[model samples]
Target: MTTPYPRVELGDLPEIDVFSEEFRAAPWEVTSRIHSPNGLARSSRGIEGLTYQSAHTVLGDRRPRIGFDEMYQATGFDESSPVYQAAVTSINNLEGDVHKVLRETLGRYFTRDFVQTLRPVVRSIAEEILDGFVPGEPVDIATRLVGKIPSRLFASLVGAPLGDAEFLEKTSDALLTVFYMDNANHEVVEKAYAGLAAYVEDLIRVRQSSPGDDVVSYLLDVERSGRITRHDVIVNVTALLRASTDTTAGQMGLVIAELAERPDVWERCHSEPGIIPAAVMEAVRWRTGAWSILRVVREDMNILGTPVPAGTDFFGLAVAAHRDPEAYPDPHTFRLDRRRPKPTLNWGMGVHYCLGKPIAQVEMEEVVRLLTERWTGVHLAKPLVTDGEPVNSRPLTALIGHTPR
Candidate 1:
C-alpha cells in the first residue's frame, strides 16, 4: 500500500535556516545537505517534524496527516469569514471520510480518459497563445506566453465564459497570494477570495438554469442528489479552479526557461517530439514545483531510529527528496533521459496526490512541444529569477527571451 522510500541512518544534520536570505536565494544547497543519507534536519520556524529529503521515506509512509486546516487556522481565519469557511470545507482542506467522499466524487472528472478528452481543447488554447508570440522579437515567456494559458484553459474547463477568463485569471492570482506572499493581509486576500467566490456563486446559479457538460453543471447534479451541500460545491469548485491554475502556470514557465537555457535539450525535443513527454517528466522532477508538504504525526514512531513523538509537526522536504542523490543518481544534474522507473513526488504522494496532475502534465507537455516546434531558436534574454522560499516561489519570472524560429 505504500511506496518504498530510501532509508537513512541517524546522523548529524545541521539546523536549516529556511527563512534566511541565503536559503531563499539557493534552497537546493540546504535541502541537499538536509537529505544526506545519514542525517535529518529541522527548520528554524519552531516546526517540530522529521525532514525526509529522500523519496522512499516520505512517499512510502502514509501514516502522516496533511496539516492544511491547522495551517489555515494559524492564519487567523476562523469559520466566521466566508473565505475561511470556504477554504476549511474545501476538498484541499477536508480530512477523513469527508475528504474521501469528495475526492471520489470528483476523481472521475480528472481520470486519464476524461483528461484525454480535453487534448484538442488544451492544444487549441496553446496554439492560440503561441499565435501571439513573434518569432524574432523578445517576449516575456513567463508572462505573455506561459502565464495566461493555464488560467484561460481553467476558466474554459470550469465553464467560465470566454469574456470572463481574464477576470477570473486576475482574481485567481490575487486570491492565491494568501498562500505564498509574506505581505498578504487578511483584508486583501479575503477580498480577492470573496470576489472569486461570488463570481463562482453567480456561475453556479447560471448553470442551475442552463446546465452544460462542464464541471459546474456536474457538481450541480451532485448537489441535487443530496450527496453534498451547496457550500461544498462552491468551495470545492473554488479549490479545483485554484488547483488547476497557478502551479501549472508557474511550472510551465520553469519548463520553458529550462528549454531556453538548454538549447541542446530543446533541439532534441524539436527533432523528436516523443522525447518531449519524458523531458517534461524530468523537468517536473528537476523543477521541484511543490517543494514541501506538512504532516502531523498520529502517534509516536521511530524515524531513522530517532524518536518522533505524537503530535509532532513533520515537514516533508520534497524539493530535497527530488534532489536526493540516494534516490536519484547525480540528483542535481538535468538530463532528459533520467530514469523515472518509479513515480516522483513532485506533484505529491499518497491519498493527497494532486488530482489535477493529468491536466498539469498535458498543459506542460503541450506548451513545451509547441514552443520547440514553432520557436526553434529560444534563449533567455534576461536573468531567470525566483522569490526567496520554495513555497509560493514564483517560477522563473522575468524570463524575457528571444525566440527566432
Candidate 2:
C-alpha cells in the first residue's frame, strides 16, 4: 500500500506465530498475549486484526482480494486439471463484480422460503439418525450420528437418494482439503472432483427429466435462461453441495459437544426451545478459533495505521474477533443471553459471506432442539479430538461420549 499518511510498518508491531500448533489448539493462549493499541498485529506472512472493529474493517473492506489461486499455484498442479478448475472457479476465490453476480444469483436461491423448505427435511433426517443412538451407550456420537446429518441433508437438497449421502460426504471431505494444501493430494482431489462431477451430471440429467422444487432445479432454470452456462451450474452446484456437506456437519458436532460440556445450558435448551437458536450461535463463536482469508493488496495501504507493503501476504482474522473482549463481553464465558454489539464473522463479513448459512442453521437448531428433547442426560464420555488447524479446525472432529438419563 502506497498511502500518503504516516504509517507504522508491520515489522514495527508485535508478532505472533499464528500457524503454530499452540495457537491452533488454543488460540486464546496466543491472542490473549496481543497488546497492540490499534488491534492489529503482525504474523509471519501478514497482519491479523484481533479486535472486532479492526477485523470487521479489514474483512468488510472490498479492496483486498482473496488469493486462493496463488495457493493453488504453489502446489505446482496443472491449472487445467479438474481439481484446479473446481478450486479456482469456487465463489470463495472470486471478487468484485464477477463475484457479486454469482453471489447474488446463488443468494436468490437461498431465500427464507427455500430454507423453510428444508425444515421438515432437517427434522426427518435428525430423527432418523437419532434412532441409531442407544440411550445407555458410550459412543462417538460426533462420527456415528452428528456428522451424517448434513450429508443426508445434502442428498435432500439435490434430490439424490439418501443412501448416496455417504459418497457425497467422502468426496466433499477430499475436495475441502483444497484449503488445507499441506494435507492435499492432487491425485485424490482430482479423483474426488471427477466423482462429484459425474454425480452432479447424472443428478442434473435426472432433475431435467423429473423436475422438482429443489436447488438444482432452480439453478437449471438459471442455466436455461442464458444467465449461467450448463457448465457453470454443474461446477457451482457441486460447490454448493460441498458447502452443505462438511462444514455444517462439523459445526453441528461441535455444537453438541459444547452443549454437553455445559449441562446447565443444555438443560435450558431442553426446557426452553426458544433458546436453541441463540445457543447454537454462541457455540459457533465460543468453539471457533482464529481463521483468515488470504488477501491481495492491489496497492500499498495503511490498515488501522499499520503500513502493509503491496506484495505482502495480508489476511482478515474473523475468528479471533469472536473472542475480542471488546466485541463479545466476557467473551470466554459461553453465555447464550449475552448481547452482541456486532454481527458474528463466522460466515464472513463482506461479499463472500456464506450463502448456505440458513440451511446450516436449520440443521443445527433442529438437531440440537430434538436431541435435548429426546435425551435426558447427555455428557461427554471423553475429550474432543480436533484437527487443530486454526483457520479450519473441527472442534468436534472426534467426539466420544456417554448419554445417560
Off by over 4 Å in 2: 1-6, 396-405
Best candidate, lDDT-wise?
2
- Tens digits of per-residue lDDT, candidate 1, 148-203, equal 88778877877886667777667777666666423445666677788888888999
Structural similarity to truth (TM-score) of each candidate? 0.89, 0.93
Candidate 2 lDDT by residue in tens digits, 1-405: 233334566777778888887877666668778887677788876777777787777677777766667656555556776666766677777776767777878889888897887888889988887777776677777777777888888888788899998998889888767666553466666788899999999999999999997779988988888877787788888888766777887778877888888888888998898999999999988775326655666577778778677766665676677788888888888887876546777677777777888888898999888878877757676678877675666755444454544
Clashing pairs in 2: 1-299, 1-300, 1-301, 2-300, 381-401
- Judging by TM-score against the true structure, name the best candidate: 2
Q: After superposition, how far is residue 337 of candidate 1 from its true place, in Å?
A: 2.2
Q: CA lDDT of 344 in candidate 1?
A: 65
- In the order shown, the candidates' Cα RMSDs to the true structure are 3.3, 2.4
Give the Cα-based TM-score of candidate 1 against the true structure: 0.89
Model 1: number of clashes?
4
Clashes of each: 4, 5
